[model samples]
Target: MSEGNHSSVTEFILTGFPGLHPEYYGLTSAVLFFVYFLTVVGNATVLFLFATNRSLHKPMYYIILNLSVCDILFSTTTLPKIISKYWFHSGAISFTACFIQMYFVHCLGTVNSFILFLMALDRYMAICHPLRYPNVLTNSTILILSISAWTIASALCSRLVIVAYPLPYCASNIINHCYCDHIGITMLACTDRAPYGFPAFLTAMVTLLGPLAFIIFSYICIIVAVSKTAHSQGCLKSLSTCSTQLIIISLYYLPRCFVYLASNVGITFNADVRIVVIMLYSLAPPMINPLIYCLRAKDMRESFLKQFRRITIPKKGQVSALKKS
Candidate 1:
């Protein structure tokens, strides 16, 4: 064992899906890679829509742009290494790299939570207090909120990494998960973890539960406001908007709360089940969020249709040129 704030283990081997059979490695890796592809493509398309389309330059889509960026970044930070691990049989990550991965993983997760909070806030203002929403949620406001989410997440998550980094690790270097995380890394320390683990757990809970409480409250208010509207079509339209956000929220938050709470309360989940739940919460929203936006948001749908026709159909000058050629 080393003397001062140093670990004897230099690197870690990521054991992705402990129960995955040897023969199924290729299948699992292929599936994950495809998912990663979808996640990137979907989020990227949303970003492109925001950049090129002037109509999406409003506050809600601004927050959505933040969400898309967060999802793409979160997926990129955590997925590639594991993909390499399964596809190329390369899971050995250095201790420093592991901690860095943990920081981004936790930090971006918190940012995603904050972005979701902003999304709900936008809805709350627009529906519950329609008159003031125009002044309240502008581009500058979204930018400030987005920047604050990133700054706060970075500041808070840095503590988790800093506190855990100095722990003495004279034990096994095998991390029993897909990627390095505070829990997976800190649990390996050769010292009593209560001093460090509890704080990390509390931080995790704060990041998840805080935004969730607000989201619930906002939606409750939204529901009440919608119910009071005399126009049935207007009520349905507002609900339709909220339904997509709720679906994305449910996908992102439910499994995560269950896992975090269950862990704290000593409810044991199967290792494979836990990992699958984690992956579902982490990966599923990013991939499907853009689809939800396009399918549900009339503006986004119309924008895409407009783009599609512009691309597939040619201008008159181009048609004349083609005929001449």
Candidate 2:
């Protein structure tokens, strides 16, 4: 493509949930809005509970706090615009804005992957090596690991953004999905994208698979250690402790792997189906994570309830005034 053509596209139009009937737009928008709202509230509740409850300040809860922050940020970065697109029919995004969205969407995702890996390690240590767990995952170490997750994710994603930023988008300006992403945006560049595409793909795979491998290994070790104890009750308790994290890990990684594999292997899925699957993995986890932690982790649930009661209880003066009335 000529330079003139390359410079033509200043913005891109996002085609969200293609192949859907026009009548369903309102319904889809409403659902997305509800999900986004819940995501924000749920994650915020977790953050608030974590912040106010000093007893909750430990390595596990610290990691949960980080994960909560990541979930909130990730949902904020992607959902509102897509909701606008569906609700208001405002789908055009400036070129720079699109790239910014693409960057954060992937960057937060990478951070979440690493956070989950860290959580898995936390669990493994707590379960498999209880004696050394506290020493190994001290508060300082947790802070460093949390910071490192964000830093490493940013550094890795920055390379992709830097490489894709200058590429000329002469081919088309319509992103087939709800939001701008590395693959969707890069495929629109008219230049030979192989140079950028291959590296980005490789980075993505490593980002997705590397921590996943560690998480799996950690869980395997956990299972083995639990099994060797010869106490069924102990084994059950250990599995119960790890179950929530395992559910979240599966939710975070499996659909992503399936989507990537399906796309690369020439397997054809309906466009709408593909987009919904993407949304499930990307959006659902953030919305469900807080619930999982609160419901599955006894400590978190009790702390939240204790805080709620403190907030809602009537003062002694108010109780006397009510009796007088």
Candidate 3:
């Protein structure tokens, strides 16, 4: 081993699911395909609805659009590799591919976290300080915040690629998860700890816990304000909105924190268990987020159904003309 310089890792073997048991490979492929398919469709629906519907042109929906983009990016960052792992019965990823996956996955994950915080704060302003909501969450401010959120997430999480690349992995090149992730890469490091560890830790805290705290605090104020509101209908509406956002935040963060933070806690000792947890962390949120929005949001529900019907129902004049022709 060289003293100061490090050799680049040529490739990484992903050991998630033991390379998909021969008997179960078909089942695994089917299941993962379905999940990835739904994730794409669901997030795409959100993007389309928000884009086409002029009524959804508010700062809140603008934020939702940003979140949808993040979700789509999040799913994209890992799902293809997951599919390849399952279908090909090969889990080997090139070092370059691994780094790219890790970078984008963390970037999207952090963006989602900050966007959720922004969402909670939006709700807080709308509910707890309605009079000041418009001025505070203006279009310009929302754009600035959204841009800042992506930039910060990308900058913060980029260190994983920077530090993890130089680590020696002569002993083992196998990553114990399907998708490239922090833990998977960290395990490849010959040293138990490295420059990667602290940077990864700091990025996780900044991207995960910091935004989580902001969301929780914002929702607390939102709930209290809702409780004090005199109008029952208004209170119900506010509660519904806050509850929906809370559920999404939970879906996004809880699994992530469990898998990432538990690395040090000894709870994620089993590699198989860790892989399962990480897969859920990757697949579940994108699946659930659009459902939550469509179910809880009346406008979204109406627009979705309206668009659905518009595509399905044939025009009466067109039908008659076709019959005549």
Count the clashes in each prediction: 0, 0, 0
TM-score of 1: 0.95
Ten consecutive residues with minimal summed lDDT in candidate 1? 1-10
Point out where model 2 deviates above 4 Å. 1-5, 315-320
- With a 3 Å backbone cut-off (N, CA, C), the pairs that clash in candidate 2 are none
RMSD of 2: 2.0
lDDT of each: 0.90, 0.89, 0.80
Looking at model 1, the pairs that clash are none
Say which prediction, candidate 2 or candidate 3, comes out ahead on TM-score: 2
Clashing pairs in 3: none
Runs in model 3 deviating more than 4 A are 1-8, 192-194, 315-325
Residue 265 lDDT in candidate 3: 53
Which regions of candidate 1 deviate over 4 angstroms? 1-4, 315-325
lDDT of 3 by residue, 54-149 (tens): 877888888988988887887777877767776886678887788889889888888888888889888888878889999999988999999999
lDDT of 2 by residue, 63-99 (tens): 9999999999988889899889879989899988998
Candidate no. 2 TM-score: 0.95
